[model samples]
Target: MDLSQEEPADWWEVEALYDLCFAPGRTALSSYRLRDDVPPVAQLCLCLWDESDALAGVIRYWPIRVGGQSALLLGPVAVHPTRQGEGLAGLLIRESLKRARAAGWARVMLVGDYPYYRRFGFEKLEGVQMPPPTNPDRVLGLSLTPGAWTGVSGMVTRATPQAAGHKDATDP
Candidate 1:
């Protein structure tokens, strides 16, 4: 299998994979609220291709803020049905996370099941809150640095333009 950074050409195909792997209303989830109109962390968004060159899996991360500190919001990762059980999802996740750490991101969070994500070093975060209707138990985080998540808390929100490495009116 070959891995590559996702390019514009892969958008529709990646979305299709996400659609296939998630429920019809997956976009309605609270996590989507934070991702709306936000470009993903370009280097951390990855695609996996099979020996036949078919798209096999994808993963994405977005910039977010928790208690005003920058954090990565991981989500929307999906693998083609044929790629399931082949650990393609794991590969995408691990690779993306490694890239995230290298890029100086301190922490990452995802809304997912502990049982499955635990293997990836994600654990339920306490004192942190996501938008309503989201189960807190599903809010998990992994620290990319020692003590990265220590004392972090509060509602997760869209990353400020500055925090996302972009400039908007909010920045001086």
Candidate 2:
């Protein structure tokens, strides 16, 4: 598969792929609430295409705050139905995470199943809270920098430039 950073021209295609893979009301989920008015991490938004040149999988990351500290919100990783079990999801995750760490992001979090995300080093975020209607059990996090998640807690909210420890890591 060929992987590339998502470009403006790929917006509709990426959205269509997300629509195809997730529930119709996916945007109603709490994660979307954090994404409102926030642009994703452009350098980390990745698209994977098969040898046939068809889009196979995608992953996106948004900047958010955890207790007012900068954090990455990873989500909406979608692998084409027919391409499931091909390890496309894992590939998308591993590649994007490497880029995220290199960009100076210290922490990453997501609302997802522990069984699925745990393999990627994600664990339950004990004191972190997402917006209402979201199950706290699904809030997970991984530290990109050693001890990055230690002592971080409180409400997850929209990110401000000040929240992003590395301004260049976030979209302007």
Candidate 3:
């Protein structure tokens, strides 16, 4: 498999892949409520491809604020059913975070399993809060820079930046 930046042409396929990989009502979940209003963090979206060029996995990030502090929100990492356990998801997480850091983003947060995400430097976010109806235990975060999460408190809200429209690796 090959890991590459996702192009706009891949967006529809990626959405289909996510639909198939996740449950039917996945988008309505409380955690996903934030996604409906924010654009994806184009620089951080990654795709994994198989030999035939089929999308095997995908990961995306979005701009968000915690207590008015800028941060990236990672989510909806989906692996094709046939390609599970090949480490594509983890690879995407690492590569995307590397790109995010290189692009000057200092923090990222996600609602996910603590055990799995901890390997990627994510820890319990003491000062971050997701929209209501989200489980506290699933809320986690990581710092790309030293103490990036320090003093970042309050509800997680979407931040719509004008530069967000600019192209990054993931753009077509």
TM-score, cand. 3: 0.91
Q: Write out the backbone clash pairs for model 2.
A: none
lDDT of each: 0.86, 0.89, 0.82
lDDT of 1 by residue, 1-172 (tens): 9999999889999998899999899999989988877777878889998889888999988888899888889878888887799888888899888888877788999999899899999999998999888999999999999989999999998875555657211121
Lowest summed lDDT across 10 adjacent residues in model 1 is found at: 163-172
Q: What's the number of clashes in each of the models?
A: 0, 0, 1
If both were scored by TM-score, which would come out higher, candidate 1 or candidate 3?
A: 1
Candidate 3: where is the Cα deviation over 4 Å? 161-172
Candidate 2 local lDDT, 47-150, one digit each (tens): 99889989999999888888978889998899999999988999999999998888888999999999999999999999999988889999999999999999
Q: Where is model 1 more than 4 Å wrong at Cα? A: 161-172
Best by lDDT: 2
